[model samples]
Target: MFIRNESFYSFRRQYPIITILVAIHLILFVWMNFLPFGNYIRALGIGYNLAVANGEYWRLITPIFMHIGAGHVLFNSFSLVIFGPALERMLGKFKFILVYLITGIIANIATFYLGGLAYPPHLGASGAIFGLLGMYVYLVINRKDLIDRMNSQLVMTIIIIGLVMTFVNPNINILAHLFGLIAGAALAPLFLIGAKPYYAEQRVFVDHGEPVFDPNRWQKKRRNNKRLKQAFWIGLGILVLFGLLSRVL
Candidate 1:
């Protein structure tokens, strides 16, 4: 439950879940295209009937990490980078991860039950990103004090734009987006009961003569989370280096 209550810009440590997720996606993307077992990884993509009927129920979760192409992955990654930290801080690490997984799985399930099997294999983090946006919208609606008016409007505008795109584009996975949004909003209450608003402004306080940098319970939790975050990034760096070395040799 480590929630770094600081501005996104002021955030010093890498975000644990977000860093690991993006790294995993990038690694998988490279594996699915550049390395062996490319075909097998592509086959792992979620197809409604194919996934469920074949007893590959894990597709419900795995597809959240798979993207169809460069454009698709970039868009979702950008969205996560843009909005994730703020929401993560608000909900705390535990709740933020819980909301993400729950909404993502729900979105996939919705697609599985409602989508036409004729459509291309559904893959990407768009659903989960939409879910995060939806959760923000819920926070804006129910707890206006937790977010400023401008930021709230920005979130609402994104949702509005997404809704419009869903209707306008035939290729879009409207069911996944819709379900993700609903899932995010529906699950918001569970994380918001005692949530505090995060401010983009950082304040420094001093007691007597020294600057206050005390490690309270929450700060200790945050420190531990940061260590985990660093570990993931280090692992990602090593993986990338190995991949590069292999390519060279």
Candidate 2:
């Protein structure tokens, strides 16, 4: 008996987190344009000093959803359309959203701290988009069959175009892009490792005609078997520590 493989529509139905994130980003993009001096607006389209002084510290994360202009929003949103669905399908909605927000915040903190406290206000989801790109690159590097199927040359071409754009666009935050890419690459292994046992167990259950487990089911067996919870907590702790360090020292 042949079992029917689920269609892409089904996969997307299971992963609404990406859709929500993209929607939020588009909303912020429109909101940015409506505010005064909005062209320079970043997080919540507020001034940098006001954002910093008013303790609107959440701006760091919120900024990741904002875009400077139509071109900026289009580029990042397009990249999200390309990568976000696949990642959400692979990692589940919760994990995918966690990775995006964490990487984006880290990238912004790196830019704010290392790039100079007085650096111009910045906005855009490019950092998170770049993180997705980096994660995809890592996955391709590790999976030879996938790399062959997708064509490494195509990946190279995209990277080259991004590099050219980085240099050509003076307004682009190259530092944020670099930091996001590096952080994403580093964290890719954690998600990949966490996913392996789950996939392997799923295959085993399917082969044995056992009841397939619900992917989102929060059971002790799934949680403990894969060490996913442990990895997530550890990763969060590390990120929090890094954020504190960046602010203090």
| TM match of model 2 to true structure | 0.66
Candidate 1, residue 96: lDDT: 88
- Using alpha carbons, what is the TM-score of model 1? 0.75
Q: Compose the digit string of candidate 1's lDDT tens values, residues 1-249.
A: 212344654453546777777777888788887899876887876545465756888888888888656656666775676678877777888888888888899988888777745545777787888899888888789888778665565567656766766666545678888999999999888888887777532335576664566558588656755754664454345334433432333
Q: Largest TM-score belongs to which candidate?
A: 1
TM-scores of all models? 0.75, 0.66
Clashing pairs in model 2? Answer: none
Candidate RMSDs in Å, in order, are 10.3, 13.2
Give, for candidate 1, the lowest lDDT window spanning 10 residues.
240-249
What root-mean-square deviation over C-alphas does model 1 reach?
A: 10.3
Cα lDDT tens digits, model 2, 102-209, are: 889888878767777577777778788778767767876774433333234444445555655665556667877888877787888887554432133234256668
